[model samples]
Target: MNEQQNKKKWLRILGNIFFYGALLLLLFNPTAKGWFLRQLMEVGLFRPQIEQEAAMPKQPAVATAFAFRDATGTMRTTADLKGKVVFINFWATWCPPCIAEMPSLNDLYQQFRDDDRLVFLFINEDADVQKAKAFLQKKSYSLPLMTNTGQVPAQIFSGTLPTTLILDKDGNVVFRHEGLAKYNSASFVKQLKSLL
Candidate 1:
């Protein structure tokens, strides 16, 4: 009877240690937090709030032009992508929310990467662009990284960590979502297809 009580006490102690260790990892480790958030997305918790067709802009409202440089050091502007549906996401290396949504973005990108009608600009807000690139490489994500070259218009970007903007073929902001969202949903794919 005494041995059974001792075993029970050890089991409780081990359980407490495991629980606390996981809690600490979630709180302090961005990767762990991102993984946890991604699990929430897998359960459809962070679904994007895309507007319906009626709510979409009847007349294409001209979106603000922003300049950025791609990983290849090629300078590009929003104006340059006027005839294509442009998908832009502003994210940083240190942001857990950005990390959480990256896998979904990658999935979405993979679906449309070879399409000439759409352009995806994953603008990294990290101070060290190399770190952002390294993170993407480590995660085996094929997202094209771009860095801000000049002041991004407030209308286009409000300095949000995980802000996403979708521009129609005419360079109009058709959809804008701020915060982590699962972008690989069938509804979102259909909306993008409709725009194309």
Candidate 2:
């Protein structure tokens, strides 16, 4: 083949390879998608901002009642976890943003796993608990996984995947973030430590 024709053929082959490679990555690799989203956040494509509530009331303005089952099939309630810094994250296995932020959330959980003052609840919205468990096990994430059993308060989760709420010791929602964020960031840890 002539030089120009050979070059054109190679370019077409490279383009096809690139297209298929990206398709496979999107189809099968959740971690790769997570990494892509993280890169976007790093480049300021989307900033995950935490809006801190200035002076949360002593009592939760909205109902704080929520029921969920733990990993061991034990039913737990938000009321059962009163007087603790409860970190409740609503997420689903299929959510790309949720998957992206999960690693950071897991890191944050590891840092405070021993602290009785703090409680981390990774509420999986997936219908199948076994599937959710498998996903976590596959990722080797140690975050506590829970499934909503009863009515979850609208104040806590308004049908938004990857929503996170930080309740103070008094059961008051101090920080409610509705997107992916770097939960393991130093400043975020400092803010959480201050609450504890």
What are the Cα lDDT values of the candidates?
A: 0.88, 0.82
TM-score of each prediction: 0.91, 0.84
Query: Which candidate number would show the highest TM-score if scored against the true structure?
Result: 1
Top of the candidates by lDDT: 1
How many residue pairs clash in all the candidates, one count each?
A: 0, 0
Candidate 1 pairs with clashing backbones: none
Indicate the residue-level lDDT of 28 in model 1.
97
Clashes of 1: 0
lDDT of 1 by residue, 166-186 (tens): 888788787887889999999
